[model samples]
Target: MTLAIERPVGVFGRKDLPDDWAHEQVTYFQDPETGLRAIVAIHDTTLGPALGGTRFYPYEDESVALTDVLRLSQGMTYKSAVAGLPLGGGKAVILGDPATMKTQALLEAYGRFVQTLGGRYITAGDVGTNSDDLDVIGRVTEHVVGRNVAAGGSGDSAPMTALGVFQAMRAGARAVWGVPSLAGRTVGVEGVGKVGYQLIDLLIADGASVVAGDVNSSALERVVHDFRGVRTTGSIIDLDVDIYAPCAMGAILTGGAVVDIRAKLICGAANNQLAHPAVERQLADRGITWVPDYVANGGGIIQVAGERESAAMDQVRARVEKIFDTTVEVLDTAKREGMLAGAAADTVAEARISSSRARRTSPCTR
Candidate 1:
């Protein structure tokens, strides 16, 4: 049986998130002692406890923040399912400018909220947050993980995410061509944040011409200073490049841009790249091969989960390296079944999750 959540009627005067965002739990938290306003959305726990990073951003209002957390937590559920992790998906978002409002008291208060859920959701770092921040959260709750290596946790997920995108981009290229290589290919990357910057390092080293863009001038300047000869684009999405990597935020494929997209492939570290759930068909219709964002960005979660299990770098990287093969499999399944790759990937994930759920609930015990 499926559960249907009531839409936020007249809340934003428009539907902000997708219709499919019927989550298992959507929780709002506020601490007057620390001035913390947050939302935590748990999408599923059929596979295991939900594990996802907690993002901190200065959203315009509570409606916008709720919309973001709902979509992001749902994406994490799909991401975890498709990545073959033994965990489910959930996410927390702290609604504030991290630079101005982040304090130990606030994080500890937020940690208290996490503990109230009793480990059904785990929080890490995303956007304005960092590993040190998770360490602070950990001090208040055992549900939190993904701290710095010195703090007995995975150090950073940015590099792992970059590596995964780079590998999966090659796989996308190979599905179009006959080989997995990006040499001499032009790749446009939007958003030069931690993961985007690391991805640039791999692309340049792989001999691909890089075009970069960001709203922040400092980010663009850092890219120009670190890597010369790379083209800086006014609009990264409109670049006439071989591949388009949207590493910033989600919903890049909305607003009629999908029809005129010139890129041969779309593979990036961003989650929920599709604004609409059905947008994968649009990419397929446009003849653009898209490695589902979750599959491509699974490396970060893989790293964090492995580290939580006390796995070494070799083990973690070995698992992350499988993303290439998984990319190929998803594309091939889509092609053979005449469906969108994202949908095909969802089929695979749902099958695995269903089997797990059935086994967990069956009373045919020995």
Candidate 2:
């Protein structure tokens, strides 16, 4: 099989790096034998070691992969900070289609690449990767989380992530409608994959009128079969619903799209929901309560971090539930300070990160 591999060569100074190269470190690994090309980016480690999932995808080229990893890694740092977790942000991206190119040797080779970083970066599961993939990566590296529960790791993070988003939705309801309940509300969910399916379950249980859609027909079918009364729509964003939850890919809420959003609230498990910073202001001007994506979907990282700390399941759930309070805080701050929700979230998260850095550098009071 011929692989469209592009090995990034030459030394890149800070000036030569991409515009989004605000990361602490960015390393590329290529194993010609196993046809494995990966990029691991560490954005920060002020609180502790960088922890994030490894995304495996078939990108068009190296530039796209770099951009994705940079954005995702930075988002993780903010996610952990807002969630009050003691983790920094990092991410890994494998440059190939998992379906056609994944193999034991390739995963193991990637694991070895992770091992070279020592304990500075921890690997988990993201899109196109799962607990089983973590299991394979764990074979060659100790710095892996979100492995199967049977394998003594945190297992899948999707359920926890969905739970966090659900809580965020509840908080959104409180902020906008003055009620902390989803009952009698109509929520439009985009993407019924791992996290979205479980979120639909929670919404259904809470008596919310659910209108869901997914690009994957099988995923849509599973939700339709499992949940009665869940209406499926071809266009979730355009649906006349109280809340629009984006659980699939990122940047769905672009400038043009925000103008047409009928939903009063936007809360979802997807990262980087706003394509540009300007979109945050647009949502605010439209009077839509937008839960910052990282703050809303941080439960998965909290779960994996708990597993790393050897915390119990109850502990993890409690931490995940705190997303509700965080959501409330971010919204309240945004309203009070006359700032956009995304800006408010960044303020809150950056405060925590900045405090950590201060404590680390300050001389000890002996």
Candidate 3:
């Protein structure tokens, strides 16, 4: 759905998503004192309240942030539903460079704005934000998750995200190679940050040879130091590996990148991996097995979702492990229907949400 927001003088430009979009709710806020200009989009709440993370990042314009948050929130809606979480999708994006603009006061200001939503949108750590930042947000509002363990919340969902992706990679291997193992497989990881590093750890532990790269030299250096003998040829994106894990930003699979991909499987933690619908067709035409990003990288939301029900970590982790089965099923459905795996996964989540909506009517009306 298309949404237009009137911007105040000197604020970021009018809010707009990259593509034509429709959403349940889109709210805009600006706090000049804290440099907090934000957009929160609630894609759906048919199953439950809109739950997702707050991503802090630098954007060239407000429209860019709007587009990112809208897509991300919608993905969270599908991610939660596919993962069997009793929650809907929503996301908030703060427009600023987190590296330079982050402060306790700013986080608290953002939390206060979130409090205005009255828990319809749950905020967590994403991109440039973390649990430490969530703790600050939590201090101001009760509608925050992924807080520090000292505060009685699950901390650092990157490991769980990685675990789920690792399981998803196994499912991809099964779909493409007729085996559920990454051992002896050469995988190229394009981004060795929080989730990427943890995924690298899992690959190493599982006896897979990993070739990792990152924009951050320090992060790449750490991966090289931690996992010795790992290859880093020219660009990580150009590696001719069996599996390509894009544990970074999205849109790598679109345009010429789709033609350049030499991997048999594409799976990673990046959101919005497919730049457009036709890109999915491109990957399918090339005989690549792609695990939907939302389906494969849903462990973080599963962890934070457990907090709402006061579930234990073991139970949460077990729930996260179910991604393996979901990934395999989505791939199977895609193959049978001749559709993209992402579309198949979205159908599963949409069906669940639709069923819930259908059940909402009163018996008296019927």
lDDT of each: 0.84, 0.88, 0.85
Shift in Å, residue 243, candidate 1: 0.2
- Tens-digit lDDT track of model 1 for 67-172: 6777678778877888888989898899999999999999999999999999999887789888899889888898877788888888878898899998899889
The reply for model 1, stretches above 4 Å from the true place, is 1-21
| Clashes found in each candidate (C-alpha, N, C closer than 3 A) | 0, 0, 3
Instruction: Evaluate residue 184 in candidate 3 and report its C-alpha lDDT on the 0 to 100 scale.
Output: 97
**Model 3, range 1-366, lDDT digits (tens) per residue?**
112222233223323332323577889998888888888988888889999888888987886777778778878888898988889899999999998999998999999999999989998888999999999999989999899999878898999999999999999999999999999999999888899999998998888999988878888888878888787643666678999999998767765787788898989999888776667778888888788899889999999999888899999889888899999999999889977787798799989988888888758547
Best by lDDT: 2
Q: What is the lDDT of residue 31 in candidate 2?
A: 99
What does the lDDT read for residue 362 in candidate 2? 84
lDDT score, residue 49, model 3?
91
